[model samples]
Target: MSGIFKKIESLVEKGKEAHAKTWHNWAGNIVLEPELIFHPKSLNDLQEIVKKAKKHGKKIRCVSEGHSWSTLSVTKDYLVIVRDMHQIQVEKSEKYGWTITAEAGATIKQMDDKLRQHKPPLSFDSMTVLSSVRASGIVATGSHGAKCAGASISDQVVKLQIVTGDGELHVFSDENDPKEMSAARINLGLLGIMYKITWHVQPLFKLRMIDFQPPIKSWLYPATLKEFVEKSDSVEVFYWPFNESELDRNDDKLWVKQWLRTDDPITTSQAELGMERVCEDLETRFGDKLYQFIVKCPESTPYITNLLWKAGPVSKPQNVVIPAPDAIHYQSGIDNILCDDLEFTFKADKDFANVAEEFNHIVDSVYAYAKKGKFPMNLAAEMRILKASPSLLASGYDEDPNAIYCFIEVLAIRHTSGFEEFSAELATRWMKKYKARPHWAKAWEHVPGIKPYLREILGKRLETFESVRVKYDADKIFFDNKSLEEVFYGSPKSTFTESHL
Candidate 1:
């Protein structure tokens, strides 16, 4: 046991911290102190530790930036911190095009910066979490944007090198095997520790942005869905809470924005100011009065931006072009704003009407609670579109190759005080009513019936995933956490007990 610690110490002599406090999650809600925290410098070092941990029957949890809104990364046993596994190497391929191999620990921003060095460059549509923190190889779940044509980062992965629970290294790709490819893409950190990933990249391009605010009454309802589908490359709607009577009569507004591939040069100053101005307008329109009232306002920027649309006639679109990486998405000023959870999707099939009804039910229910003073002070719903991909776990499941993604975010101002309770209840309702599944990385728990719902919705794909899991993780080496067990194995209680190495 002491030898295991010594080996880890040798690899990460400086970053290691003993008796360290359990890390806080991205939402700042849950924290757990692992028995030991090890940062392995190389894949070999990781394999060494995995070998020892398996021999001694120790449970392991691999952590990245700890940006998950859920407890998936929490562990009380052996925790592998892979922040030092950062490396970016690109190679040109004549057959499959450009292949970029990166260590899982590299941040998305770092990868984007490196890709820009190419002649034509390469780019990803969105980023997960903040760029400063080291991102885990898993892409840290639930980090997606509103590009219907784009897939989650995991979907871009072409190959991966993972260390199985027994410390055996397996290089998986589509050409070598299909089972390995499916499981490796979503791995859920359950197969083993992912060491390296290779992804397919497109030559760099610019993204054009046009921001508009439109009245909620004019846009979000069933009537506008068709027009929304045809008019934009990517469209998102955000709603705010104000006097319901006033809003119903045309007071509340919606912010709509679109992004398309373009040939324009990047606009750094305009992008920054656009975000700041959006924030400022939100603060100005709502004022501190709403915040003090503890009223859950629609995220100020989106709502205010929407109001701006109603203030004038819709005209020629305003255009702003920036580097694809920089222009991909914006962090609405709620940096401190924490969500109980978020769920969005890429597929809206026959289930669209049913899902829409369920969504409206939840919204109406929340509003009813607010009217009764039973609602928390912060919460908002957002809707967006996405194009489907091959990744099994991707939200854009198989409705259409290109489908709209809708997001409903329940933000919590105070962690305690009914916010958590309400959000949990709402999640359960969503699962029961819409057969909805929560994002793996967001704030959601595996309720009793969730697995069956997933199986029913995902059909044979779910069975295929299980078959793949059985092949890669016959012993369940990566099933160390309760949440993960619930997600993969449908266990109401975890069977694997924690053992120290």
Candidate 2:
């Protein structure tokens, strides 16, 4: 045997986590079988896998939960599952405050379970609704909470331990290595596999979640939306697009959800968390029959949308007060139906910004789609408020670091035929009209003009990220496939088909 082959073979045995397997993400939307899927149990185990992959001229991708809709985690050669590396060490300080250093594979749920056990307890300013997502996955992809007081999940990170393509473990922090830290904060799994994530946490606090179905006039008027967000700890609004025609209401209506820091204390559990009962009522009580009927002929989108609001438990107004974790999350309930989601962010510093304008246009398209016999969207469009971010890759581009931004999510239900094409049209318009950017984890990478839009908005920050990327993984050994290539390299193949636009 050749000397090089013998050396590579020896290194392969050192990577005990390696194995062959067929795998699918949690949502079952994406599936892939890698030649070898490695579940590293420790930092050393992870380093060994990287060393072997680099030696053998193989590519690697790290995945946890695989919640992202994009093909970012898809790879044929090597897949590294870091969940087994779960571990954590926490520290409290009089000067720096509470800091928790958790292995990348650890989950938000796990962190909350442990941190809340502290004498004073601790929690993140915001967190994704799905607690099962890994800390590494969410932070690396820039997952966010609905709170405007906090930045993307990545922004909470104070330090990171990463195993780069060359199998070296490097720790970078915002204070000491701002440039490197900026890139590592939202590393995109390109620099390397994250081994440990350290975050700054706040003292455990109580929050109240209130549900309001305000009249359409309230949401349509920019003044109301601004007040709702400015007064609440966090605010989210859901607009039922076909409401005017479907519900037979005088004007459109929105499910306005607001969360506020409360002295009310944690005093809720079971049969009353409210969300479970709400989803149940949605399926059984108020509008189940109507919703099911509309499902058969989604062309009657107005009916389905009406059924959604009617079925919801918040007929008048409802309130729930719970622990910080429970209050921050809800069932995202994204999977029950096959669908595609597209998200865009507008500046909206003090008010709706360009959103008020672009929103009107999209509403027009909703009517056009329905008029052309296109399926009407069955789910509510989600609106979230994001404060200015320190993470360079945050959708806002960090231009106005202190400015507030609003994230709007448009859901395209699969039950309705040709929703993907319609979504593509909406996403395309967002980038061109608002000069918006998509949340990294969702399905917006395919939108046309994405790279150019990001390039123009990000400016020097993009170049800095690219330079730091090259510094960490000079060979791009972690480059998994064409999907990753399209993002980092800006290749033409990574974009959506023009026809979809």
Candidate 3:
């Protein structure tokens, strides 16, 4: 009825390939040419587009930045892009801490910068997929911070405003009318378009980071991971792969310990110079060609440290406060390099041996695949721990208070080179053996029987999620894409069923 809706309709009817090709994901993995891409500027504009699509019976799906490694955001129908809705409003609260409200399109960097302006600034410890934060809301998949005691970005949500499939807007929060806040926290774009989210902030605190290299097996076993967390405010491990010969064993891993403390001003000039020195040494020893090759792979891969070990080990300790937001999320050098390329996450039980066994299984599988000419060398896996949340489809699922998040990263290469099949197989085997749940934003598909598998394992929780979906989305207008449907409901045709069978 509105002029904007009419213009959107004209664009969809045109069905131009040029329009379709313009949409690309962060890793450049999925290139979708949607029939219509809606760039709505306001909540009203979004509602009109959705209403028209529902009325016209056009299959539609919403996409953020396509930062997800999976094909979840890809669709041939109408693809909603939420980039223009970047508005942030900060308010001081007397009872609770500060509350910051932001549109879905605002980047994590933007949120962090804005929050810093207030006294006793609050920190959100979650890492974000590069370029992916622009097109989606912050709470969609419950993005997490790295601190063991820290909560995911979703947990910080105090309020949310979502536009339902039928173009009805709903507001929910703890203080206001509560309607399944857990389920709403990580809705996977299946519930509705989240227009705005408000986060409760903590007082600003400085984090002291101590970086040390230790043998992963000895220093970062299951027990060690728990102990490290208990000892420090936050702990993260980075395992580097050995050279091409011994990819199974990690040469050295970087362990960073961050603790809350008063500001102790220190100059970063020395740390920056050290990093530069290390980089220069690497360049000299490995040569530019090999150094470039190493930079292409994810930092979690065991191969990275192998090259470093071959060159030489750091003689002295390194200490520095993360200067910028990106510095904290993106580690220096190889860690930062690989993040721009690929990302994946899996949820597993909190058993260290179980986790270690799975890592070994994947490593062994990579070796076996390499022998058969099916493995790719340009990838890495990061291991992180998270506490379970009440969200239905959350990776942590049902478990003890805490769970582990293993993020696997691989370099993005041309699909024709068999990397796609290799990655798929890797994901399949991991899920099959470990019963791992893939990250919503990362690359993965719900194979056949996964729904049933989840139903069996998760039991009533799965049923509750389905019931909520049925109540909220009867016609499935919100779930226009296959991936969303598969994740929330069931997949009619699943590769898991045939492959597993």
Measured by TM-score, how close is model 2 to the native structure?
0.87
Cα miss at 454, model 1 (Å)? 4.1
Q: Give the poorly placed runs of model 2, Cα more than 4 Å off.
A: 1-20, 241-250, 267-296, 313-316, 332-338, 414-416, 452-457, 491-501
- Tens digits of lDDT, candidate 2, 45-151: 88888888888888899898777777778888888888887798779867559988899889777888888888778888789877778889998888888996767
Name the weakest run of 10 consecutive residues (lDDT summed) in model 1: 492-501
lDDT, candidate 1, 280-322, per-residue tens: 4465345434343343443342343234334321432456777
- Candidates' TM-scores? 0.79, 0.87, 0.78
Ranking by lDDT: 2, 1, 3
Each model's number of backbone clashes?
Answer: 10, 1, 16
**C-alpha positional error of residue 492 in candidate 3 after TM-score superposition, expressed in Å:** 10
- How much is 125 displaced in model 2, in angstroms? 1.4
Top of the candidates by TM-score? 2
Model 2 clashing-pair count: 1
Alpha-carbon runs more than 4 Å astray in model 1? 1-21, 129-143, 243-250, 265-318, 332-335, 344-346, 349-363, 377-379, 399-407, 414-416, 424-429, 446-460, 487-501
Candidate models: Cα lDDT each: 0.61, 0.74, 0.58
Instruction: Please write out the lDDT profile of model 3 over residues 1-501, one tens digit for every residue.
Output: 699998997766453212444587656667877777877778887787778778888655676655566566666777778877789888877755688888878876677777776666665544442323641444676566566555456776777788876788877676653446666777777777878887776655555667677665566556665566566655555433454335544443443435434377654655674676567556544443444554454433344445544453344455665433433444323322322223334564455655555555545555566556443544344555555565666765544445555544444333324455555665566667666666666555534355444444555666666666666566777676665554445543333554563
Better-scoring candidate (lDDT), 2 or 3 = 2
Query: Compared to the true structure, candidate 1 yields what TM-score?
Result: 0.79
RMSD of each: 6.6, 4.1, 5.6
